[model samples]
Target: MDNPYKVLGVNENASQDEIKRAYRELVKKYHPDKYVNNPLKNLAEEKMREINEAYDYLTKNSQNSTYSNSGSSYANNNSSADYYSIRNDLNRGDVSSAERKLNSINSQDAEWFFLMGNVYARKGWYDNALNYIQKACNMNPGNREYMAALQNLQMMNNSYRRPYNMRGYSDRDSSFCDLCVSLWCADTLCNCMGGGC
Candidate 1:
């Protein structure tokens, strides 16, 4: 992987501009946001870690080093036994074993379904990824993790958009809030005037 640092295109003495550019480009290419319902977050995290390492390496050599990016800082530890098992299998490159482990579990919580969906996304089966993430979202409607995964799958088509343009529209995407974009203001007005409940 070409000096994980070099692959991210940063140097041991790169400027803040260069580091930010490299990180942004790589993050855009492998953003968890792009793969929300994706099974490939493990890969994305790998990329993130590489980018972070490259950034850290560069910053340390420079005069402006600040804000260390560490693994524990992400805090995505909402894991379970099955999730951990799946993670191990994935790290070991045993996708089938992970899938089998997932199937062996009886209780399907949001984390379980989300990780399953992530596995599917890694396999390039976006449809199944979508299905699993949706199930996860259903199990935990308020869970940010599940919701973020489900939304990520939905954003696949627009995943390449620049960060400034990347957005998650809940009212438009959520079934309960599927209000027409054009009539949003009018709808609000009507509801305020006691016209439509």
Candidate 2:
């Protein structure tokens, strides 16, 4: 609503590529998925909406210097609005409501898959979540939000154990080694006491 460049944190003279990069970063930062279960989810949603609007305005009026005079609105479709509502529901931990709304949608777009992934993730179904999020990333390769979600899921899946080489010893193995050392020490002590040293 104000300066588009300011909204995106870019200068007026910034190149188109720079503007796009900034927009992508902001989108990633304030994505609904990142704000899930956070108290600041509403604020993040508002920020994301503003970022989307600014990006749309800049791209549409790139040729014209008088960007402020352009009265063009963001190209928000009904499905997109619905997706935003679903994201709000998901953020509030209402997976069932979000799932119901998502399933009612006629078009299974990238956003749909992304939202479905969020629902699955909340339900502790990581495998299904990863599958759905991967599909979303595949469908919208350039979408930073979808790509980030997929990366996060993959990282979570691999976070439990250290690599084979890095794993020096497990707790069970260490305990066994400790027991062996104690028994050997006791044997040596007993021999010394019996004058066998």
Candidate 3:
């Protein structure tokens, strides 16, 4: 086991409250929901494990034995490391290999699309990234993780300079509303011109 304080990102002499604060911040950053079905979910889980261990070690011998994981903590049923290793390989900068591995995956869910988008993004294939991330969003429109990935793809291209980059949206400048509205209007006009209505 690594030093509890170091694992929790706090000084050894940190007060219990200080340690708790650091742990909470890390939890917020690596929460499972934030990365649900993410290719990096495994990495986040590893981080959560470290955080859990640190909290346990510090709380077991401390006067304040009030430490608990804010959310579910299950280490037994984690996915095989083969999948995670493939994710890491993508992160290591190999799009072709990543895509090939992705092709072999049976669990093609939102995370899979998001990861494919990541590989495309790294290879400067913004168009492909956009398409894959859009598929991810379509798969899980309610999931903020997939939403964020699609947003990132939009922001990466054109820096959101022309339209989707509306003010108050965010640094990512992601928005399909404006584009969708425009396309809808165009479709409506085309329908009006056609006599096949």
Per-residue lDDT tens digits of candidate 1, residues 1-197?
Answer: 32434656754445678777887888789876787778998888787776665555444433321223321111222223245557667766788888887888765656567778888988988888899888877755756656777888888834644353235544436554544654797878889899565
lDDT over C-alpha atoms for residue 139 of model 1: 59
Residue 133: error of model 3 in Å?
0.7
Q: Write the per-residue lDDT of candidate 3 for residues 112-185, one digit (tens) a residue.
A: 67778888888888898899888877865655656777877787685645564454575443546667788999
TM-score sort, best first: 2, 3, 1
Q: Model 1 reaches what TM-score against the true structure?
A: 0.38
lDDT of 2 by residue, 50-103 (tens): 899778756754442232312211122445457656876886798999999989
Provide the lDDT at 34 for model 2: 94
Backbone atom clashes (below 3 Å) for every candidate: 5, 0, 0
Query: CA shift at 111, candidate 1, in angstroms?
Result: 2.2
All-Cα superposition RMSD per candidate: 18.3, 12.5, 17.4
Which regions of candidate 2 fall more than 4 Å away from where they truly are? 1-76, 160-197
